[model samples]
Each structure stands twice: as C-alpha cells, then as structure tokens.
Target: MDTTVSVSAEPEKKPPTLFERLLINRNYAFMWVGMATSRLGNVVFDTALLLWVATTLARNAPWSAFAVGALIFIPQIVALLMGTFAGVLVDRWDKRRTLLWMDGARIFIVLALIPASGLFHLPFPSGSDIATFFQMGCAFFILILLGCCDPFVNPALLILLYDIVPEDDLPRAFGRGQVLNNLGTIVGPPLAAGIFFTLGIQWCIFFNAASFLVSFLNFMLIRPERNAQKEEVKAEQGAKEEKKAGFVHELVEGLRFVGGNGVLIAVGVSLSLIALGAGGLNTLNLFFATDNLHATPDIYVYLDVLYGIGAIIGALTVGPWVQKKLGVMSGFCIPGIVTGLLLFTYARLDNVYAGFIVLFFVGVSQATFYVSFGPLLLKVTPRKLIGRANAVIGQLSTFAGMISIGLASVLVTSPLHNKHLTLPGFTLGPIDTIFMVVGLLALTSGIQAMATFNDYKLVDKQEETPAEKSSENEDVSQPLISYVGRPGWLSTKKRQAAICLVGFLVCLLIILPVAFIAPSSTAATVTMSYGHPATGETIEGMECASTVATRQQLRTHLTLYVNGHMAALPTGIGIVSPKQPGVRALASNGNLYCLYPLHVFEADNIIHADLPDTRTYTLGQFFSVWGQPLSRTQIADYKADAGKQLKFVVFDGKGNEINYTGDPGALSLEEHKTIVVLYNSPDVHPTPFTDWNGL
Candidate 1:
C-alpha cells in the first residue's frame, strides 16, 4: 500500500497578535521604554553640544572649533570598537543590571560637569598676575574624559534594547524610537540656546546631565519577569560544564554571521555610502549659509528651526506611512529620493529663504530615512545577535564617517574652491560643488534602493516558515546562531586595535602641520617688565609687546627727516611721531617735540616702516638707549620722576632724537617756535607724524 497521507500544511503560524508581538510579555515594554528615554536624552544632549560648540564655545575660544569636532567624532570611534564586546557582555550578564550600570555610569559622568565648570575658570596665580591657562586646560581635559564614556554607554544601550523587544515587533519599536529621536532634535537646540543665553554654558551642561538622571530613574521602575527567569536559568546552569566563551570568540562569530548574511552585508554597505554623503553635506552647509546665500546668524537659526520642524513633521507623518505601504526597502527609497532632489535644488538656490526651504525638505528626508533604516535593521536582525549586528553596522558607519570627514576637510579647505570662482560665464564655489555631489549620491542611492525593494519582501516571507519561527510564548531567549566564527587575520581584538590605530594616524596626520605652524602664527610668549630710568624704582610688569599695533592712538608729524633735512611741524593736536623716523616725544601735559634738519623734507601723519629714506625703530629703543619694558603706570609716572631735570629729545619719523629744553606741558604756548621738518622723499614712503594728516 503506497498511499501517502496528504496533510495540508497548517497555514504558517499567522504572525502573533499585535499586543503579543510588541509587548512580548512585560519585559519588551520595559526595554522599549528604557531605550526610548535613553535615546531621547542622547539626541538632546548631542544637539546641545553641537550648538554650544558652533556658537558660544567657539566664540569664547576660536581655536576650539576643530577640537570640538574631534571630540564629537572620537566617541563614535570608541563606540564602534566596544559595541561587539558590549553585546557579548549583555548576553553573559544580567540584562537588567547591565542597563542599570550603563545608565548609572552615564549619570555620574555627566554630573562631573558641575565641578568641571568651576574648573573652567580656575585662576593660576603668578605673583600678582592670574593666567587663564589652567582654566582652559581643565575644560579640554573634561571634554576628552566625557568622550571616553560614550562608547560603553552607546553599545550597552543597544544591547539592552535587543534583550527586551521580541523579533516581530522590533521594526515598529525602532520606528517609534526614531520619532522620539526627532522630537529630541526639535527640542534640544532651542532649549540649549535659551539656557545658554540666559544662564550660560554651565546651565546647558547641567540640564543635559539632569536628563540622564531622569532616564535612569525611569529605567529603575520597570520590572521584567523574563529577566528574572533568565537569571534563574543562568543560576541553574552554574559552573559545571562551563560554556561561557571569550569576548573575541563571540565577536568573531558575530562578524562571521554578518558576512554570511547577504541582507546585513548589503545594508551595511548602503549605510556606509549614505553616511559619506551626509558627512559631505554637513561640511558644506555652513559655507553655503555664510558665503553663498549670505545668511545672517538669525537667518541661520531660522533655517535650523525649519529643518527641525520638517523632521518633526516627517517623523509624525511619513515615518509610519511609508513603513506600512512599501516595505522597508521601498520606504527607505522615498526619503532617499527626496533628499537627493532637495540637495540638488539646495545648491542652486541663491536666496536665503529659498535655502531654508530646501533645508526643511532635507530634514524631512533625513527623518524619513532614519525611520525606514532603523526599523528595517531591527526586523532583519535576530534578537540574540542584535548587539553584534548593530555593532557591525555602527563600525561600518564610523569607518565611513572617518573617511568622509577627511574628504570633506580636504575638499572644502583646498584651493580648488577656497573662494568663489568666476569662470568664463558663471561663478561657483566649493560649497556649490559639494551640494551637487551629495545630490547625485543621494539620487543614486534612491535608485539602488528601488531596484532592490523586492529583496525585503523575500526576506520577510522566508521569516514566516514554521521551522524558522521560534515559540511565540518564549521570552528572553538566545538566538539559534549564537556561535560566530573567528576569521584568522581579523580577530575582534585586532580589529579594535586597527580602528584605534587608524584613528590615531588620521588625527596625527591632520593635526601635525597645524601644530607645527601654530607657534609661528600665535603669540609665543608675553613678557612684561618695568624699571625707573632715573629713580631706580621697579614697577609692575606688563604683557610682552606684540608686533601688531592697536587702533587706539592717532599719529601726527612734528617734523620729517628725508636724508637729514627738516621742516616746521604740522598744525594738529593729534600729531604723534612714527615708530621709525619722524618720531615725536610727548610730555605728560601733551607737548610734542621732534628733531629737525635744516632742509625741506617730505613729512606726513602716517606710520610706514618701508617708506623710502625712513628709518624704523621701536618706541622704547628711540626713548632709551636700551630696550626696556614700561608699564602703563610707569609711563604715567615718567614726568613726576624726572621733574625739572628731564630734557626731552625727539626724532622725526626716523628714530633720531633732537634736543629740546622747555616746560614739558607748555608746547601749546610755543607753537610758532616748533619747527616741522620736511625732507625730499618718494611719496611711496609717506609717514604720518600727525593724526589729522590723513583726514
């Protein structure tokens, strides 16, 4: 009897009911809420930090702009390497306890800012002088320390999310998380600006620190039965027949799994490309706003607000609809297309308002992209492997970001587009070219996504098979493919070391030239000294004189010496001698004296060292035979110390001093007696001996 009993395959277990799928017992909801809160806080913190750097922090110290950017990126590199180990740790340890530890660590780290702020103004006493070096050093140290903590927190958080959420509802959970993230973006900047403007940067830092505390408290409230059960199973497993693997072993397994999974590898590459494009756009946006569109600070703020508003709108509207309508791949394509079109138009927009409108659309596109990509990643990845998968994705993204940051730096700063270039018929700048390239990449990505839309559906259908599906009732279970393979050359430890090396090398290469050149460009050291020429009294020290002069004093010529010739002084109360030749001596009561030769010479109220037949020398060198420092107070006391014994000698625009005897303050009474010397010299070297001569 060859009769085979025909049995209809039970309709593949219809996906679980919505509540069962998402809530997945109480643990899923707890994990979701915890992750959402943490993510929200992080987004807010990042926005505030970036804004602070771009405005107040940079304004307070202009040189810190690049440092701020470095701080922001350094953390990302750390997170990439730590993510793999963090995932393994989550599996090995009590998930709830891990969450608590991570949150607690973050809270403590952030709260350190309170004391750090005070350190930012610490006074370094040197005799009677106070230096700001200590304060600036403290701020820099705190920022670097803060950067270190970010890696552990980010990976631990992602692992916790996987522990709580069921596989089926992962997508929707990610979508909701994206919404909250966008909400944070909308709120964080304005709040930061308001707080900074009103209470200063310290307040903004404190507010962000407080937010972590709130999230930590919220996490403590959730009690999950699944985690308790897992604890019991782990306890029962005990020390007999040990199965805990090394972190490297687990990390290798993760890499192997990702490499084997076509879907994950594709997504990873796509994300990398996307990050590259986004980075380029970031580099160009400021230039476009400031130089191309001529946007004021207020206008830039408005444009940022518009972008946030658009993102919020997209999160509320398009994020959910696209996910439901077109499957994950197609959903991502919509935003990609929008982003491309917006960027294309962004480059061409000449009006500031038009640029703002384009930025709004760009924000909308980014929000939608996040919604699609986040959920898709969650859905496609196995629950147990979520940490590794995310880690891999993060690592790839960081790699792309590093490359993009480099490319952007070179392209934007290079001579090709350092300034606006006027071609035969048109003008273009680096920013314009950047926009065009970003648009093209985005458009290409959109097309690629559309072409691969069906792949998502195929994967989705395959996930519905009976053998593939895990028990719906099971909670907090590990994945079937838990053991990842180790590649020979690229172990997890080596990979991490490689990442650190790459980062270090890139930073070293980029910074070495600047460091080498900085000393020459910056004020090397300031020196001040005071001494009494006649009284032998020592005065307070003043700062070392800079070669550059300030716009405080006006100069007028009392005489000019061109090849040893002199003339009568010009009529002006604001007359002063040049640093080089035609130098004038001012008495405490405002009398001017200058040396004059017996011939007509060219003279003017200007200061120029390169003037023909003019000799230049420092003011101190002209007054005293030796170069000696003088404090403002010492200058003020010069007449009192000299008394009637002071004999004044003045030089023309040149440093040669001539003898004069009179009451120091009585120059106004003897105006006719003052002789201004003019010497024959080329007009190219006109010297200003009087302040009013130029006018």
Candidate 2:
C-alpha cells in the first residue's frame, strides 16, 4: 500500500499596476521625482525664452524670430552629429556619475547666461542694432554648451533606466516618467510667464539652474546597486569579448546586431521620417499662434497648458488602452494616422479656442505613441546592444530634425513668409502648405506601418522562452540573426564598418548646411547713424559687429568719391567703417548695411573694401560693392547736366580738412581720416564724423 499525498499547484501572481509598482520601487521613485522637477524647470525656461524673443524682442521683427530658432537648433545639430560616438563612450562609463556631472556642469553653464545678458544688452534696447544680434549670438553659444551636455546625459539616463527597472515593470516606469514630464509641461509655462512678467527672464533662468541642482542631489541619493547582479551578468559577457573586439569592433558588433533586426530598422526608419514632419511644428508653432491665430501670449500659454493636460491623461490612460486593444504593432500604427489628422485640422482652425481643443488631442496622440514606442524599443533590442540601437534611432531622428529645421528656415525667411500659393482648386499659405505636407507624410507612415505589421507579428511569439532568447549566441555561426536567420550585409564585421562609415558621412552632409548657411551673429559691435549732419537724423543703435576680426589691428582713413568734384567736409555711405571686417561684417547684409537692431537693409548706406594704407579705390569699386552707380556724368541719381557738380572731401579728427581736387576715385584712404561725398549739393558742406575715438 502507498501513502501518496497530492500537492496543490500554487496560484500564479498577477503583476502590479504601474502606480502600484512606483509606490514600492524606491530607485524608480527617485528618478521619477528628479526628472519631474528638472523638467518643470526646463519648461519654464523654454517658455520664458520664447516670450522674451517673441513678445519682447522679435515682436515687430518677425524675421528675427528665425535667428532665435537658429540659436536653439544649431546646438542640437551639433549634438546629433556627435551622438553616436558619445553613445560608445557611455557604454563604457559609469552612467550614474556621467549624469550627475553633466547636471552639475549645466548649473554653472546656465548661471553664465546672466552675465552674458549684460554683454548682449538685455531688456533689449529699442533701437540698438548690435544689441539684439549680439544677444541672439550669446544665447546660441550658451545653448550650444547646454546641448553638448545632452548627448552624454540622455544616453546615460537611457542606460540607467534599463539598469534599475525590472523588465516587467518597465512599461509602468516609462509611463510614470511621461506623466511627470507632462505635469511639468502643464505647470511650467504659466509659472515661467509669471516669473518673466514679475521678475524677469534672468530669474526664470535662475530657477532652471536651481532645478538642475535638485536633480543632481537626487541622482546622488539613487542606489543603483540594487541592479548589481544584472550588471555582473553584463560584465561577464563583456569580458568574453575583451580578447577579440576593440572599441571600434565592439561598436561594429552592436551595429551588426541592429542591422540583423528588421523590426528595429523599420521602427527607426518610420519614426525618423515622421520626425521630419514634426520639425515644422516645433519650428513654426509659436509663429502660427501669434501670427495666424492672432493669439496673445496668455492664449499661447493656455494652449500649451491644454496640451500638457491632455498629454498627462494620455500617458496614464491612452497608452495602456491602445496596447490592450490593438496589440503593440497595431497600436503604434493607428495613433500616427489619428495624430496626422488632428495636426492637420489644428493648422486650419481660425479660432484660437478651437485650436486649443485640437492641439490637446494632438498631444494625446503623441503621448500614446511615445509610451507604446518606448516599450517596443526595449523589447527588441538586446541588453548588450541597447545603447547603440538607441543611438542609431536617435541619430536618425535627429538627422531628420536637422533637415526639417533647415528647410523651415528657408521657407519662413523667403517669399514663403506670408506668401499664398494658388493650387489647382484652392489657395494655401506657405505655413498651411507645410502643415498639409507633414500631415500627409505622417498618414502615409501609418498606412505603411499597417502593411508592415505582418512582418513583425512573430516578434512577440514565445517559440523561444526568455532564457532561450538570452542564450541567443548558442549558434556561434549566426550569433545574431536576421528576420529569417539568413546572412546579409551585416553578416560580417567589415560590412558593418562600411555601413557605419557611410552613416557618418551622411550625418556630416546633414550638418554642413546648418553650420554654414544658417545666420550666425557676433558680439563685436559698431555704433552707426545715417542721414544729413544738418538735421542729424541718424539711425540710432550699435550695429552687430563682424565676426571676422582684423589680421593686425590698424585704423584707416576714408575718402568718398562722387561725380568729379571735391568738397570741404566728409560724410555719406559708411560713418563707422572699421579697418577690420570683424565688426563690420556683423552689420552688413552682403555688401549692404543693415539698420542694425532693426534688420532692415540700407543698400545706399554700405561700406566697400577695407581702408587701404596707400592704394586708392576708384569711387566706382565702392559703387560696385554697394550695388549703386557712380560715373563722370552722374553720382548716384544726381546728374552733372543739371548744373550740379559732385564734391569730395577729407577731414582729420581735429577739424583740419583737405579739399580733394582730382578724380573722386584717386583720393587716398589715409589712416585716421574721414571722407565725404556731396552729390550735386555742393552748397551743403557736411561736418566730419569726429567720433572715431569713441568707436
């Protein structure tokens, strides 16, 4: 007889909800709090910056808005170019330390913007040409330095998030982070606007600096050692490759892994294309609100608040709901199409409130997409190759953004600014056209995603258990597998290297135009005024000085040429022509002078070549460079046939004057001298500009 007892099977435990997990997880809680606080500061800083540029500085000069955008995006352009290499470094460094130091560095860098404000002439002098340009340039440099910190900071954060969060709880971890980020978005703008209106942009910047410190301290408190076992596993795996792969080879290995994965490539590529459309929105949304919707600053703030609210709700509800209903792939595809429609509708709405409503839903769609996409990214990418996979996606998206911003710059600044396009049956403005194009692209991406869904249906198939997948290299001959486990371009390390080299060149091509073609301002300046010395109606304001400085510092003389006559005093085209183009170039648009601060071109008021030590310029070369006409019979529009003779004169700072009695072109530009040309108005003897020392 057998005395056998039947044992009951233990019930399976259900996973905790996102909120429940956050409540119990200490490290995740710290990261969430730190990110939320810092994000609040970022939103406030961005709002303050936009208000300062739009309402305060570029309100009247809308084109100057492009300059403001260039300042912000130029750094992003640089960061994208270097992001891949930076990711390689992150894979080898202590992620926690890297994040902490970067935040610390940001605090000091942000504080510097205050002092820079003094140099850039903040509170924006109404008529100072050099002040606004110089300020924009200063803002650019500050943001550029800030941007350098991101490539390191972001990748480290990505790595750390994976390091600390349990795989099953990751969806909740990311969702909670998104909710907090959106919370910052909701509260930050209004707070920034309040601070900007009450204290100033400086205080808003100060708030951001302080927030960085908060994040830094929180980062210090986080105990990443809870994930020590996982880290050990990674270390052991890394040790295996130590004997075979060098840095480049290791990077190539990651590339080969990603290249062999079809789902990652498809997601990365589609997102990149969609990002191009999103660029126009980022670059032009503020302008659209202010210019097209006729919205006030308060309305703009309100619209953003609405968007934030919707985003928070969506992050909490929509993401999970979509995944449950449509599965991962289908959920991702549906949102893109809906988001496109919402965005397109937003562009066409004339009523601000209607726009506010539409943009809220747009935010919902975006948050949902992000939530779903984040998990998909983590699911498919291998632990060892996660950094490079993310780097590849980031680089592609950034490259798209760079292209879009460049295109936006061209469209916004050219005839497209306010010009309307007459299509076959309807008329659309340039901005509207941009919206339509972006909308169609997003919609097309969604349709393509639907068609591609079947290709990845088996991605979630459990043919292999998690352990089996983890032991993916058991087949050493094909350590990394393609969709069909077939060898392709990434079959060899050499092929992977070739792909990486080509990718690097592509990045270079994308960044070149942003660096070279975008309008970059300088801090060096020159005070300028134009008009008759009698009434003395001068163009008040310092001009943006040229970025190019003199090879060897030297002062120069000026001698104006006209018709064929000489006068007794100096005045005309350039009142403050420095010996160097460094400061001068700042004030020139091509060869034409800008009514600085104003950005208006004064074609007649231009400086030609640098002052010569001994060689003289024919008054004709001046006209050629100035895009004007100078001849024996006519000086400018003034004609010699009308009983009028051109007069040219030279003067020293001390009022000592010499009447030139030769061809106007023959006069010498001696050092420390002033030249003037009186065209047909010989009776009007202009006073020499004696403020050379002040310049």
Candidate 3:
C-alpha cells in the first residue's frame, strides 16, 4: 500500500486593525489625543487671530486688505526662507522632544500676543491709527514665530507616526487624521466667532494657550524612555557626516532633487494651480456671497460648515472607496476633476443654497485629493529624503497661494475693481469673475493631473502568489512545455522528469560561460557569505557594493533595548558621501557617493542586505558595514550599566525568543528574524519585533 502525504498552506496573518491599535496601544493613544486636541485649538486660534486683525487692528484702514492679507502671506515667506534647514534639523532631532518644543514655543507666543496686541485692555486710549498699527505688528510677529514652528511640527508628526504605528496602518491613520482636522475646521470657526464677539480676544488667546499646554503635557507622558547623553557620543560619526554636508549643501540638494523629478514637478504644478484658486476664493468669497448671491454674512458662513462636513465624509468614505476601485492616483485625479467642475459651478450659482451645496462637494473633492497625496508621496519618495521632501513640497502650494492673495488684493483695487460685466442672462462682477477665472485654472490643473495619473491602475487587485510568479519565470525560459496549457504533453512521471533535466541542462549551457566571462570590475568588492570566508579577506570600511540592481536584496530587523526602552537606529551606515574629505571609497558615476553591500537607508530597524550574490548574511557582517563593534560585552560604544546584564536574543518569525550560546555576531540573519540586543535588564520579558509591516 502506497500512502501520500498532503501539505496544507498556512493562511497569511494580517496586522492589527486600526481600532485594535487605538484601544490597546499607549504610545499611539497619547499621540492621537494630543494631536486631536491641538489641531482643533490651532483652527480656533487662527480664526480668532484673523478676526481680530480684520475687525480691530485694521478697522476703517484704507489698506485693510493688505493688513489682513500680509498675515496670511508671512508664513509662506517663512517656509520659503527656512524650510530646507528645518527639514534637516527635524531629521536629526528626537521625535518626542520635537513635538514638545513645537507646542511649548507656541504656548508662550500666544500668551505674549495677548499683552503685545493690547487685548488685555491697556490703560491708554484705544483705536488710534498708531495703536492699531502696533497691534498689527505684534500679530504679524506672533505669526512669524508660529510659522517657524511648522517645519519641525509637520515632519515630526509623520516621523513619529512611523514609529508609533505599523507601516500598513499609516494610510488609515492619516485618513482618520484628515477627518478629525476637517471636523475641527467645521467647529473651530463658529466657536472662535462666538468667543471673539462675547468673551473678547484675550479669552481666545487664553484658550489657544491652554490647548497647547494640554498637548505639551500629553507629549511628556508618551512612551517613557531613557535618553542617555552618551547617545550623542555614540553618534559622533553621523554628526561628522552632517558637519561635512552642511545646511547650504543639503538646501541645494533638496532643491535639485525636487526640481529634477518629473513626478514631483507635475504634482507641484497641479497643487499650485489649485492653491491659486483656493487662495483667491478665500480672499473674495465673502463679497461673492454678500453682493452676488444677496445673502447675509452669517448665512454665507454655512458654506465652510457644509464644506467641512463634506470633507469629513470624503476622507472617511469616498477617498478610500475610490482608491480601492481605481488606485491612489484616481483618488487624487478624480477628485481634482470633480473639484474643478464644482468651482466653475460655484462661481456661476446665484442662489445661496446652491452655493452651499456646490461648496460642500468642492470640500469633498479637495479633502479626497489631500488624503490621497500622502500615500502617493510615500510611493515616489526615497526613504533617505522624506524629511527634506516633506518640508519643500508644502512650499510649492504656499508660494502659489501667497502670490494669489497678493494679486487678488491688487485686482480689486485696480481699474478692474468691482467692474460688473453684464451678459444676456448673467451679470458678472470682479469677485465672481475672478472666481470664474480661478475655476478655469482649477479645470486646467485637473486635466494636467489626469495626464500624469494615466499609468496607475486598481489598487485592490490581489497580489500574485510565489508559485504563480515561479510558473511565469519558468514560462519565460522553457519553450517545449507550456505551463499555462497542455499539461498532459508529458503524461508519464518519467517523461516529465526527463523534460525537466533537459531544460536544466539547457539553462546551465547558456549561463555557465557568461558567469565565467563576467567582468570582475563590475563590483569593487567580493562576495562574502556567512560561514564561508577566504584567508585574510577583509571588508572593513566602505569596501563592498555592486553598484547595480542585484537579483535579491534581503532585509533583517535588528532592535536594541537599553534599560527597557527601544533604541533608535542611527542612519548613514553604508553611504559614503564624496564631499567628505579623507574618506577612502570608490567613486561611482558623477563621483557623488559610494555604498556598502550591507547598509541602512534611514533610522529604522530594517537592515538592508544588498550583496553581490544571494546568501545568508550574519549580524557580524551588518556591524562591519556600520563600522561599529558588536559583542556580548559591547554595542558600538555602549556597555552594560552598573549591575546590569547584556543579553542577545534572536526571535523567529513567530515571535519566539531564543537565546543562543556563542559569539553574538555569528548569528545568521534570516528573513524578518528579529535580532534583539537587550542591555541592563535581565528579568524583563522580551518584546518581539512584531512585523516589518511590508518594509
């Protein structure tokens, strides 16, 4: 009797859902609460600030539009001036501390604004032209201070989110965040209006400060970790690299990268045109409603409320549904098209109710477009340049918006001021006419965006299985036997085996001579697999790189816990920038930089194994690429604290921690096998590296 064994495939495990992470996760909870509280506060504060400028400081002034518009314009100016260096700074700063500092600084600034703006009720007489100008100056200064905080705040939020949540959950988290922000926009403006009219500007300032204080406290409570001062000492090499590539160099590099990439340029163009229209709309929408629609100012405010509600719906439902159906590009492109149509319709509509409905859809489309941008940015951006890229991308929109606001102010003051054009059926004034022009610009942007979005397809399509991929690869090589059809061409098992042998022999015949004749100069380094080494062979500092796409690039997760807190992995392991003098490394094309086979792209746990050939890489080899010492007694320059033990543990894919007895560096790095090094804690339970999260 012959018996056959059946093999069953294990079902793939999914990452914890967003709700699960929200309920159980402490780190994420703190971040979410803090972000939610502050975001609403920021909107309220902004609305109040603008109201104060318009109603109090710039009241009855002939150049009141310029006074109010300058406040809006200053931030964009600051971003253009300071964003590049700030991006690099955020990359190096501690993520938690960055959040704390951003909030803390704003709290003080707002508090000072209360006194500086004379909102606290000055003893002297009020409402003089000089007094009004002083108050405006104070408000402008506060805006400048807040603008400086943005470069740190925005990039840190994204970076910290990367640390707090798994990679797969990022899109969901960001989507929810967008919804929360839209809700804030809906609620904040009304609240601010009430407080400004009833409680006074001082009260608004107080509320803003209180909100920031709450955020600061939450940041203080987030994931307690020991930040040893010696970490600075350990990162000396990285610091030296930073010093070599100073702010000016990085600024130039950022400009070059953003300007050179076609995708980013296309994206920038799309965003700029849309922003131009939005800014112009913001500047003139009130006049459009009051004059064109003959609506009360209070009733026109519902336009924003309706827009915010629609945005929330789009972010939560429409955005994801569309992205699933037609990919992330469609989430952006489709929304852009819809938004353009809505803008044009909004301009033509004379009924107030119709205006609200049209603006609501406009908000939906705009929010969907913004929500989709995060994923698309991640898709195109290199891991090494995320911080710098984030800083610069926003400036593109800001640049366009600032210019539009300035130009909008000019158009109304010039000969075109309120010049109503009468047609057979419609009468168009400067405000509505400008909006119509803005609509045309939006339409052009949408068309341009669609042109760039042509190649991307449905995002929800199922991924190909490994077996299917193998069959496809085989089909490319073998001509005799068709795997797709006619499987019975070789019926007997013997005939199948014979055919396989022939194909294998044919592959070898074609490949063997090319392998022997392949140029040694193709790579500047030799392949050194784990457990096999030639005598006196050394791959010390900056010695190994293939300089071309390899057959496979493996990854291993390496985590370190110092006194029970997770440690941050330092960046720039394999890279050797050419600008650094006295650094001996091979010059590549354009003599820009060189790389090692084993290196890390950023400050993450994933260690990239990009050697010349496919083989098992060891933990020791990784440390060698890092140019750092690794052993039971030491990690880089770190040693066990007094009375503490250093334990090295390897966790398999299933999260089972296994302690091995041997040289720590000799341990082989299997795919997603987390190599954990714990210092100063012997009794604590090992926290497994859960998932690489598709990294």
Instruction: Judging by lDDT against the true structure, name the best candidate.
Output: 3
Candidate 3's error at 360, in angstroms?
0.9
Error of 3 at 607 (Å): 71
For model 2, how does the per-residue alpha-carbon lDDT over 1-695 read when each residue is reduced to its tens digit? 13332222223455767666554477777777778778898888877877776544443343654754675577788787767778879989999999898889999988888864542434432223455566656677777888788889877988788887777878667656667777887899889978876677789889999999999988898888555679788888788866665778767876776666666666675587578777777777666665445455555687888888888877778878999887777777777888878877876765678888988898888778777786776667656666678867877888887787777666665645434433466445555556665666566556555544544443442555777656736432232323433355444334433443453454344334334443321111222223221111232222333221112112223333333233211122332232232232222223332221112121112122232122443444433333345555555445676576656676753346877776655554333345666656555555443212111
Q: What is the C-alpha lDDT of each candidate?
A: 0.49, 0.60, 0.64
Best-matching candidate per TM-score: 2
| Backbone clashes, each candidate | 42, 10, 0
lDDT of 1 by residue, 1-695 (tens): 23432233345456667776655556556655666556655654554455444432332122332434454555656555565566556567765566677677777776665553442533322101112233334455555555555555555556556656655666666656655666666665566556554465567666666666666776777664456766675576585226647668768878887776545655675577577667766644544664456553324445667787888887778777877887666777778777877887888776788887888888877778876776776666665567788878877877887666656556554432223434466445555755666676676556555544433343343545564455444222232222233455664334433543553454344334333422221121221222222111111221111111221211223333333333222211111222232222221122222221110112232222111122333323221311233222132223213222222334432223445354332222111122222223223222212111111
Worst 10 residues of 2 by lDDT: 595-604
For each candidate, give its TM-score against the true structure: 0.55, 0.64, 0.58
Report the lDDT tens digits of candidate 3 across residue range 155-235.
Answer: 888877767665577766776676678888898888877777567678888898998999999888887333454356448
The local lDDT score (0 to 100) that residue 63 gets in candidate 2 is 65
Total residue pair clashes for candidate 3: 0
TM-score of 2: 0.64
The residue-level lDDT of candidate 1 at 653 comes to 27
Give candidate 1's error at residue 186 in angstroms.
Answer: 0.4
